[model samples]
Target: MKVAVLASGRGSNLQAMIAEWQEGTLPVEFVGVGSNNLDAMALTIAEKAGIPVRAFPRDNYNDKSEQETDILNWLEDIGTELLILAGYMLVLSPRFVRTAEYPIVNIHPALLPSFPGLHAQKQALDYGVKVSGCTVHYVDEGMDSGPIILQETVPVFDEDDEETLSARILKKEHIIYPEAIRLLANGKVKRDGRRVIIQRDS
Candidate 1:
């Protein structure tokens, strides 16, 4: 499957996905990388992988909808079938959402429906939790409330600060995100209402 990744940061997750692609573990191609911020490092990462890249000026764009339209057209040009939001921060307008019949996945730093949005690792630490994890799920209108495809947990250590906890969860994220892609590419996940049924592989 062809995949487009959107991100606004360093894109450690993007590196993991691209690495999987290079190693032939993921039956996917990096179609393009779109970033709301011009300075987003994902653009550089994608270029390193010889993936096409696009960046837009957030303040100068007419509106998010117009920019998203342009992005969709660009992806369509490349035959991108799946959208993988590694670290894209924008809420996708319904324009794109309505037409994304294929997969649009996002990886979150903490177990979703728990520590969603920013600073997820800190959210877990502040809540005094003993365990935290990462989740790969479909991207719906909700913040992180999509059908979960996969998750992996890490023990929140007693000495853990925000950085320490995030470091731990990120390690697991590297594993599950690629696994989620494998499942999706292999047709092992089907959405039924709000649930993602992990289909039995024949």
Candidate 2:
């Protein structure tokens, strides 16, 4: 499988995926990394790995449609079969999501349907949930409302703050995000309605 990653800000999840790729665990060739921020650390990580990287500034485009077009064109040029959003900050336009050639995967810090958007850790803390975790899911029009692929929970300690809680959940995120990729690569993921079934290889 040919893959591409889209990330904004520091790409801790991207680094985790790279670790999996280096260990020969994830069965895919990364075609490139794309970012909306010109100075995104994900671009730097890709450069360090010698993978092609591109930054598409939304500011340069007059409208979201143009920006989406540029991104689609870039993905097409590289023949990307899978798109992974690892800590990518921007919400993809509905048109972009609908026009994707293949599945798009995303990792969220907190168990989805609970904390669906930004500041997920804070959301968990504010909600006073005894348990918080991470989720890897397919991207759809709804925010983090897509079919889930994998999830791992972490207990919330009494003394835990947002940062501490986030760190713990992030550990789980690193593990399951790559595992999701592995499942996708091996033809194990099946979606029926809103549910995702992962059939183990026989």
Candidate 3:
């Protein structure tokens, strides 16, 4: 599979994927990395990996539609078969979600259906949840409301704060994000409405 990543912050997840790919554990080609922030470390990681990188800073476009259109066009040009969102902060407009030609997936720092948007870790902490974790799911028009592909749980301590919980969830994110891509790349994942089915190897 040919893949492209969109990230707005540090690309720890992207770096994990790249490491797995380099180790021959993930069978995909990273075609490009795109960011809305020009200074995103994700772009630097991509460059270091010799993958193509592009920036679609919101300031450069008059409207979200225009910016997304350019992003879609770039993805098309790169022949991207899979789109991965790794800390990409922008809430994609419904049009962009509907217009994208390939399936898009994202890693969220909390078990979804609980915390859907930004500050998910903080939300989890504030809610007094006993467990917090990570989720890898398909991207829909709604924020983090897509079908879940995989999830891993971590215990939330009584003294845990957003930072500490986030760090724990991030460790899980690094593990499952690449694994989710591997599942899709190997045709082991199937979608049944809002639910995702992972086929077990025979």
Clashes of 3: 0
- lDDT tens digits by residue: candidate 2, 5-87: 99998999999989889889889999999999999999999899889999988899998799889999999999999999987
Model 3 has an lDDT value of 0.94
lDDT of 3 by residue, 81-164 (tens): 999999999988899889888999999888888998989999988889999899999999988999999999999999888888
Candidate 2: worst 10 consecutive residues by lDDT? Answer: 86-95
In candidate 2, clashing pairs total 0
TM-score for each candidate, following the candidate numbering: 0.93, 0.97, 0.98
Output the TM-score of candidate 3. 0.98
Q: In terms of TM-score, how similar is model 2 to the real structure? A: 0.97
lDDT of 1 by residue, 62-152 (tens): 8888888877787788888898888888888766877666668899899888988889999999999988999998878777888888889
Better of 2 and 3 by TM-score: 3
Task: State the displacement of the C-alpha of residue 182, model 1, in Å, after optimal TM-score superposition.
Answer: 1.1
- The lowest-lDDT stretch of 10 consecutive residues in candidate 1 is 94-103
Better of 1 and 2 by lDDT: 2
